[model samples]
Target: MSAESPGRRLGLRGRVMLTFALGAALVLLLLAVSVFTISRGYLLDQRERSAQRLASADADFVKRRLAAPNADPRAALMALDPAADTILLLLRHGEWISADGNPPPAPPTPSLLAEVAAGATTLEPVTVGELPYLVVGVPLGDGDAFFEFTPIIELRSTIQVLGTVLAACALAATVGAALLGLWASRRVLHPLRSLAGTAASIAGGNLDSRLPEDNDRDLNTIVTSFNSMVDSLQRRIERERQFVGDVTHELRTPLTTLVTSVEVMHRHAAELPDRPRRALELVGSELDHLRRMLDDLLTLARTDAGLHHDDEEPLRLVDLLDHVLAGQAATPVDADTDGPVLGRKLALVRAFTNLVDNAERHGRGLARVGLHAHGDHVLVEIDDHGPGVEPAERERIFERFATGRTARGSSAGTGLGLALVAETIAAHGGTVHCTDAPGGGARFVVALPLDNTPEDTIE
Candidate 1:
């Protein structure tokens, strides 16, 4: 398999440190290689130059000794030797000679010795028996010769040790860089963690929680923006709540008067004319509308205040759907199930009832109700054979007072049925959404956490 993507698999700190460590190690390796390569060449060149100077001067001293009459050239060369492990070669009558170091039985050809003895310079690096050597050839007086060889074993050993130490240092530095990046990332992310906690608190019904202010310019800007957003949200929610409350309060007095007048007219229907009695009937109908509106308002208030109770228990979803559907006038819906779900019994019942009622009012009728386990959650779906909701307005229709029927001609409903369903499901720590049904029309699905233990199973 290919390597795991760092972005997908690695945590923030791990990714940051791994990237830094790899980059730093690569840089260190490149630097070490360049420095070592360059230094090796420079050290060899310096050694060669030193050997060249010493050999040239020593050859001159040997020439001077041979020039003095009656002086032994070998003895003179020996006396001039101020260093150990030296060699001296003299060229006489086109033949090569050496003193103070061993030589082969046959010296270099006459042309080669003449080339060296004529001061034709040669400075080249050579290796013998796996040992590095610097070879320099120099001329002596009138066909005399000198050759110098300096072993570079010590220099090679020093360079090798230096390279090893540098490599070790680079490795150590890479590790240090990785550790430093981890620490830096943690410090940098601490403020973000705090901001996340604050946002989560606000989401969990704590509107007063606010992000802490850090002096960092970027962080301060973020904190300011977040607080502004929360403020706007809180203000809007309060205004909507006040409007619902005021409308409910205003409708209460009119409703009471209408109800009292309708009851009186109903008792005296014989004395009152048919038209007046019909008007009284209209008043009773309007009273029903007012009561439903008030109840809707109260439900919205309770949802907003987070007042829903969650007494979780085992619930047989299929049995529940069968019972609710039996109460409806239409053909009983198909209630199918594979397993029970765990949730608050009363709230879930209310939610299911609202969904079924919504379908009955708007849809042709309820088509089916089915339940099954999906991974760790239990899914309950209600299918309705109605004109399916418009794709764009599906979510909007769940808002309070948002009805599927048009203002012109529509079924009378409080328009809070689906909204209540949404809220109740949320209180039970479940999710609800609408989509196209399998056969046709709309389907509403509620997914709640599954609990299959004996005590958690429905009868």
Candidate 2:
């Protein structure tokens, strides 16, 4: 047998409901058969007994008529009446005779005839033409015999009505089971739905998200375990962020002093020789790089620790990118579409500047920049005319502390620029990724959700 997915097969609730329906149908069918059998047997028994009694009485009267002077079998049978829908027949001197001079409705079976000929009374069910009848045969002395047939159409009708009622009941029970299954399934799967929702919230950066308490024992076990796991993860992340924040705070003062001291040294650049001047310049560049790296780490730490301010506002994507590029070289931009996006102005600026800076430092300078809207999102593409990002490195490029060669052969980035870009964009409910740009170069694409309406609706 071929394997199939769980979704393709009948679901749990459907199976449960089907089980109940099938079980009820099987049991009801058995009961209906049994009841019909018993009732039919009982009714047929009473009918046969009553028929025998009436036949006996009719036979007694015919016998009396035979005893009379000039008596005739045909006349006696025709004259003697029994019940409605009953046919009488008489056998005298090896000849069969029916009342009304018509064909007999039912003739005794050979077995019944043999039993009756042996001087014993017999009763058997038989079909007369298109209808059903009971044949009662009684033996008379001197090779004489009598038979009676009675129609049982009414009894068959009653049984039919009974069968219909039973079938209807089975159908009703099945429908009720389906309704019950629907309700029970929702109740049974409610906890699972809650778990999924909480997990989604956490994935969206809500570390405090937790499953609520449940009353069911089995469900409660899963809830407790999931909540405990989330709590542990949250605590570990908290400790790590706290350590990063503390370290960055400690380094800030010394780093500022170093930069200030370097600026003072650059003022007297003419007195120094070429070698010394170059050496001083290298120190200042390294210091600047270190300072940028530390700042990126601190921002990440604060964001993770939930200490970042939410001073967000609505801003246009075109304006945001234009301001970032205006500080440096000219770049092509398409500003035909896209609405404002909700974000912090400083954070958005910082992330966009990092992209431009990374391009200038590593990817052989920015080749082209494009901006447009797609559906409910604003897409920003920054292209560098250098060897594009490797397919294998595309996803990893966004990780913190991830270092790799720029489009150029040299690895000159702070290793945290793209990471910070990804983090900041994600904070604004956006995404950033690397791809191969059109015409063979690297591309950094950022997509932020469009905020078309006001910051908050007011009536």
Candidate 3:
């Protein structure tokens, strides 16, 4: 058999969960990006507006002080309030002056100072060294400008926290989506699993197996269709089995008469010519083969129709096997083990006979036949000195009409013997299988549940 591809081997549930997780992650990522972008813009815009207001107010205070009669430019710049995290720069006559004690690492750029000198106000974000700040410049009347630098470390921290929270939420949402996918997949596939089980039971010869009624519309439709199909298949199989049973039943009387006539011819063979005697022998042999085939077909039909004539009785398995072996020409090395089984005598006898016949035809001959009790079961092992069965073909060979590559020695089997044996044993709640025997041959083992009850008797 070809191996399945790895990519295709993922089950439906896993695939659904993966898809849900991917979709949820994608949505959450988009939402996170939108929220971060909008919040960051709002925070920065509010900070910039507040800085512009403070700078404008400080510029008006310095302008009023500078307009005084004995105003000193440096002292007037120093009169304005400067917060600890804020720096105030005054540009007068193309020179920058600081209102606070500490000055900026670098003075304002020429392009920015020129913009402020041309009667335009500038509010922009700037970074100095490792710290982020907002720069707001306002042009004061008469060739001077006031600038404020406000540190924005708190805004940066708030945005970082928001990003971390959004990421965590996205992760949690992805996990939730996976869990939801698992639950949904199980709910969806439950009916399918039931259908598969019902189909398997039907395949295993339980024709009555069926799906339960469901309230879901789609599932109900499927269940109805599946049950209807099984009903039709069961009816068709029953019809075929019935036809075989009826045909074989009708042919029995004629076949028996033919056998008797051939036997009479064999008795009077001395009166016939050599060629005519050979022809009679061939006819008799063919008729015998045909008779056995018909009997097997009748048994199978009855088995299929659940018509078993089970006269349950306590049977000594070793004695029964010895009797069967004695009936055959080649006597196997038999072992007498103690075990009693509750079963029908005729059916068990026929089943063992079929096994012996199969071994003789397919294998060289029976090498050993033994019976033993193990726990609550009795095992009968029939060993044959022939080419052993392949592992793959062992079970298939028991199926009706299934032939394997084995030594037949000149005898072609009807292929129904082992199948009949299997059916008979199964009816008695037993199992039979072929395994490798000692000294390189095939061994057929039949395991029947032992019945040690004191009330055991023939019915």
Candidate 4:
């Protein structure tokens, strides 16, 4: 009925790491693309200039040879040989001729021929045989045109390799950014984690717990503020404990006198009227109730003041319960406590006494008290034949002076008995909760961890 719900949102650490990873990826991708694009354009420009220069020189040489007094144009064209990956073509009288044995994969385009015939030189990039090529066209003095095709396969390969390397580096940088973000998040959240731990210790009654000194200016400010706050809170608690101790001493004398006077009056009841005798009994009962309330309050004050008896040695859960049950009036119980449990003797004795009294007073008398082994813990369960706690008020009843809860209904016996039980058990690192008993009654289960770790005290 009181199960906790888990958070579903991404934590601060996850968000921080994702931010770093995305930011690095975006920036690196942009940089990689820019470098690749710029390098590709510059390299292609240089190749075009080199190809144009080589083709222009060859065209000039063939033109001069044909222009000589005894020149034979066909012989001159045949003598012009180009490299393996290059193809040379000459246009005369509207016919195309190859200067070398190897012909171009595609014939010269009309655009290149028209531009050369217009007395203009042209350098055009085109695709031939599925490979990149630069076509250079030069017009001759004899109304012919010269064309050269050069393959740029090596330049394309270099650009492709560069692109691959940049992509890999960008991917690596993204991974490195994620790792960096994780480290930074842990480093930044360390102080907050410590603060939370210290707060929990203080809430669990360790008044002396404080944040450690920090060298960072901002962190040191928080450390100083937290320690100062705890110091103030501890001082106020100490003052309240002192007031309770003083009040206990001051009230005991008058309370003892009132009880004595009531007892003396009740002894002479047979001689008095019936109404007077009944009134005297009522006065005596109320006085006893008041005295119990005061005692419960004093015990709580002492616990908060850190006045618990020390844990001398490890004690088995069964032996401890046996000692508690043996000293009291006979009660039916089902015992199975077998493991070592760490606890303070006096505090645990009072806690068990309160549990028994609570069941008898609130739950129509104690049905049975039993112990069971629960893996690494021991459970001491008390059952009573009374209506079980309401599901909505189950957790509220554990609070000190809880407002309106059916878990500890009807404020009988000082309203502090269940609270004391919770406190004492919590001090020993245990918990007490209310649930439905097997026979449709109320069950109070005290779960105690079986820890044999040596300690100075229950605190």
Candidate 5:
């Protein structure tokens, strides 16, 4: 049998119902067999006793009649059974004679007659053609014997009906047990289903989702443990977010002061020595890099804390791409693809800028940026002509601070560009991924849903 057979593939509820049905069927079958056996035995025993008694009375009458002077044994035997269905016979002088003046349906076998003539009583069941009969034989004083055949068709019919009824009752009991098992399974697994739903809600970012209070002690323990674990996880996340937020907030003031001092030094650079002037320029560059990293960190922390909201509005896609690529050296291959998208303009701009910057820093420079409509969404492609990303690192490169082999040895980027781009696109109910570009290098594709209703809003 295959692994996915009907019996193996059955769910828990179905399996439970099957188990109950089989158990009930086995028990009912055994009970029905026992009842039928006992009832049939009792009925057959009673029937045999009645046949024996009737035969004995007839045999005694025959004996008395035979003792009388010039008595007719056949006449006495015939008078004992008025019904034609029953036959009486006499065995004497090695000849068979029927008392009713009719041939018996089945005559006694020689062995039976020999036993009767030897002074031993013989009782046997026999079938004559298709009819059933019980035969009883009694021996007489002169080596003669008397026999009677009783039809038992009615008794056979009764037992047959009883057997059918018992079988039907067993089937009904099995069906009832299966239905009861189904009800019990549903009732028992209801809480577990609810727990699964609650876990799904939490996994989907609804961390506040929790199981309802249950009075059942067995269920309450599981609910309490799950809720406690979620509580601890939520608290730990909040603490980490708060730590990032605090550090970023504290660095802002000092960063502002440092930027102002750097600008002042740059204004007076004409008077400084050449080496010191170059050093000041490097300091200014480092400060700018530090400031951008801080900003990226703050943005991530805010997103984690669910503090930022998208201001969605209808905006033309062609105009958005043009505005973002105005000063960049990148070429727009199909910026004329016209469509109005409902989104936050500022966030979309940031996301597009990050993609273009990522291409410039890691893949030499942006070769082309294109936009086109595809089904219910718009596709944006940013192609770069430099050495493409390795297939193994394609997905990992999108994670925060995840740099590729080429960028790892250099300080060209803070490694948060593609990560932010992924987050921002995801917030707009879109998806982003990288693949090998046509001819060479890497291509980043972003797909944004065209019908951006309020229900798709991201927090």
Candidate 6:
């Protein structure tokens, strides 16, 4: 990247997709957090309720069992410790029996026990061996009593496992949400990708490339706007080029006559008085040069406008060459085609005549003029015997007003000559180039497409 770089980094498609993905991801994260918070809280609340219910139910069942007749109350109480981690205590007539499991340290004291003995039920938090427990006490038959205790450690362990599982689920959901976000982003970006590609093609010089019509109004507007702009730009540029060419061509003939008349007058002006004649002659020569320039400009304009007359009919290159080269000695001018070009006879004559004239005017004589079939085109080569144009100057000379230094002094024609040749060849859907001739000097070759209607050929 240079300072002149086009300044586009992320294309429209990529930017659109990234935005979509980020939005989705954010939504997913919010949803996951909300769900995890509510669900985890609900699960823990339910677990707490279940722990309380189990403690109450076990206490009632043990009480009932101990009150039965001959129940070997101690054994009955021990039976209630299904997990073997349960603690049971029986007190009768001031006597106490402890089970194998250590009793809850915070069991009711004498005063609290007295209250229970007086037919009052008690359920309260207690501590045993530094561990918290839920203690439930109940009155027994005949002044005896029962106590049941449950440690909170088991409940804590269960909650820890549940918490772990919830956390894992939340982690997985977050990851899944990110992937979903990416997928959605891609869907939203597909059309943008198409738009970007079309834009790039147009920027690279294919003005005809356009985005496809889409039903989505948001994207449809963009595509329509871009296509419209391209259409207008192409049309405007073409019109400007045509206007310049036409103006140049329309000025040629008048300028040529003016310059020619001035030159003839100046050649004979020596017979008259010096001062006025010399000045008039200078004006005439300058006008002649100006006229030649105008003619070259007009030729270029016609080529650009594609307005050259081309009514194709059978016409031999041999005869046309003879007429064009009449009164001038030709080195070699041959027609190798099996048939005449299928185009406006006059325009073809002018095109080839211009090339021949240029060679003669600059090289002092025509070297050769011939045509050959190449691929799907016809190659017309005009060879001149003067010192060849340098490779560097070949392309430059085809520009407006360019003149090769060696030939510049000898020829008085406008620099628009080769520029016209290039444009004319292009108008006919063809190309022209310069290269080395077999016998030396320079060879100018024009390749014309041979397909399509003969009359449709470029003038």
Best by lDDT: 3
Q: Write the per-residue lDDT of candidate 2 for residues 1-28, one digit (tens) a residue.
A: 9899764587777776667667777887
Model 5's alpha-carbon lDDT is: 0.83
User: What is the lDDT for 449 in model 2?
Assistant: 95
TM-score of 4: 0.90
Clashes of 6: 11
**Candidate 6, position 188, lDDT:** 75
* Candidate models: Cα lDDT each: 0.74, 0.82, 0.84, 0.82, 0.83, 0.67
Residue clash pairs of candidate 5: none
The TM-score values for the models, in the order shown, are 0.72, 0.86, 0.79, 0.90, 0.83, 0.48
Residue 434 displacement (Å), model 4? 0.4
Ranking by lDDT: 3, 5, 2, 4, 1, 6
Can you give the lDDT of residue 242 in candidate 3? 84
Among the numbered candidates, top TM-score falls to 4
167-283 per-residue lDDT for model 1 (tens digits)? 999999999999988998899889889989998888876778888777899788888999899999888887887787778778788777877878887888888888887877887
Per residue, candidate 6 scores C-alpha lDDT tens digits across 1-459 of 566433247554445555655665666667666776776677656654654466556656766776688766556566664444556676756667666544444556776687777887665656777776655566765787766665667665665766676666666665665566567667777787887898888665466788889898888888799789888987986788678875765666566677677767768888779898978967876676776676666656655555666645555455666667775664556556633444555666676777777787876567888777777777788888877777877777677777647343454667777777776666555778888788888888988766444644422
Q: List the residue pairs that clash in candidate 1.
A: 89-145, 91-144, 91-145
Model 4, span 237-336: residue lDDT tens: 8888899888986898899999999989888989999899889988988999889878888888878776765653566666666666674456645766
RMSD of 6: 10.9
Give the Å error, residue 411, model 4: 4.5
Q: What is the lDDT of residue 147 in candidate 4?
A: 85
Model 3 C-alpha lDDT per residue in residues 1-459, reported as the tens digit of each score: 999975468788888888888999999999999999999999989988888888889888988888889787678777876777777777777666776545556566777778887898888778888888888889996788888888899999999999999999999999999999889889988998999999988887789999999988978889999999999999999999889999999999999999999999899999999999999989988999889889899888887787777667888887788778886656753655576888888889989988887777778887778787778898999888888888878887788876535323334676788888998898788999999998778999999999876744522
Candidate 4 achieves a global lDDT of: 0.82
Kindly report which residue stretches of model 6 are placed more than 4 angstroms away from their true locations once superposed: 1-222, 238-270, 274-282, 312-323, 326-329, 339-342, 404-411, 451-459
Which tens-of-lDDT digit does each residue in 54-107 have in candidate 5?
888888888888788987766767667534578788765556678756666588
